[model samples]
Each structure stands twice: as C-alpha cells, then as structure tokens.
Target: MIVIFQYLSIILLIFLPMPHYLRESYLASSMLYSLVCSNSMKSLIQYYYDQ
Candidate 1:
C-alpha cells in the first residue's frame, strides 16, 4: 500500500498538468495517509490495553 502511494505520488508529481487537481489530489493523499496512521495507532493502543 505504501509502495502504491509512492508510485502515485511520483506519477502525479511528474505527469500532472492541472495545478488545481494536483493540489486536490495531494490533499486527498495526505488525508488518506493520516487516516491509515491513526487506524494503526488505534489498533496498537487497543492491543496494549488488552494485554
């Protein structure tokens, strides 16, 4: 999943022509990343509490 995201970032950086769409995609990617990170952290905390 990280690999796919990196490829997407590279492709967007290299081939994107519209400034507005590029900005929108960048924001979308960052939001997705944060959501994934938060989910992982939540699971980690829950595991610790369960121990």
Candidate 2:
C-alpha cells in the first residue's frame, strides 16, 4: 500500500498540474506522513514481538 502511494504521488506530481485542488494536495501530504508512520509502527511491532 505504501509503495502504491509512493508511485501514485510520483505520477501525480509529474503528470498533474500545480495548484491542484486543496484535497489533492492534502492527499499527497497524508500519503507521505502515512509512509513514515507505517515505518515506525512496523519497527515497534517488531520490537514487541522480539520480547
């Protein structure tokens, strides 16, 4: 899912015009944040299981 969003944002950033609708910009930002959050959550889960 993260990979998908990364690809999507890349495509959107490339092909789409600037000054897009507010929601579109927000989606891009949220995708970036979700990627970071997901990584942290994955590590935390791994640590929990390691215990």
Candidate 3:
C-alpha cells in the first residue's frame, strides 16, 4: 500500500511540470496525509484486536 503511494508520487513528480515550491508543498501535504491515514488505521486495528 505504501509502495503504491511512493510510485504515484514518483510518477507525478516526473510527469507533472510543477514548480519547485509547488512540488515541495505537494510532497509535504502527501506526507502529512499518509501519516494521518496510517495513524488512524493503526488505532482502528488496535481497537479491533482489543475486541
């Protein structure tokens, strides 16, 4: 799943002619999104495991 996101970002970086600052913002936002997603997923899994 993480590999898919990595490949998507790499493809976007290569094909999209975004400016340097835009690229940085995109990367930062994506990283934050992935972090939140993973954290929530972990908590959900833990909840189920505890049940």
Candidate 4:
C-alpha cells in the first residue's frame, strides 16, 4: 500500500549515508515501533465498533 511504500522510502532516505550496522538497527527499531502503533490503532477502532 501507499503507506508502506512511504515508510520504506523514509527509511531509505534516512539510512542512505549511514554505516551498515546503524542502518540495520534504525530499520529494526522503526519496524517494531510501527508494528506496535498499527496494532494499537486497530484495537482502538475495534473498541469503537464494539461500543
């Protein structure tokens, strides 16, 4: 989807000049945080629907 592509592009831009290890760590943490945020948003929408 567009959102995923945007996320990847942003990551690529940020890491393009960094060392390999730093890039890997940045990507790993960004992915984890995005996953958590997406899940939280999903739960919030579900809660609203259940109300």
Q: Give the Cα lDDT of each candidate.
A: 0.80, 0.79, 0.88, 0.79
Error (Å) of candidate 4 at residue 14 is: 5.9
In candidate 4, where is summed lDDT lowest over 10 consecutive residues?
Answer: 1-10
Q: For candidate 2, what is the lDDT?
A: 0.79
Q: Model 4, 1-51: lDDT tens per residue?
A: 646875786778675798879877877877777788889989999999999
Query: Which residue pairs collide, candidate 1?
Result: none
Where does candidate 1 have its weakest 10-residue lDDT segment? 9-18
Q: Compose the digit string of candidate 3's lDDT tens values, residues 1-51.
A: 886977789798989999999999888888888889889999999999999
Using TM-score as the measure, name the better of candidate 2 and candidate 4. Answer: 4
Would you give me the overall lDDT of model 4? Answer: 0.79
Among the numbered candidates, top lDDT falls to 3
lDDT, candidate 1, 1-51, per-residue tens: 865776787687668676878678786887788789879989999999999
Which scores better on lDDT, 2 or 3? 3
- Candidate with best TM-score: 3
State the local distance difference test value for candidate 1.
0.80
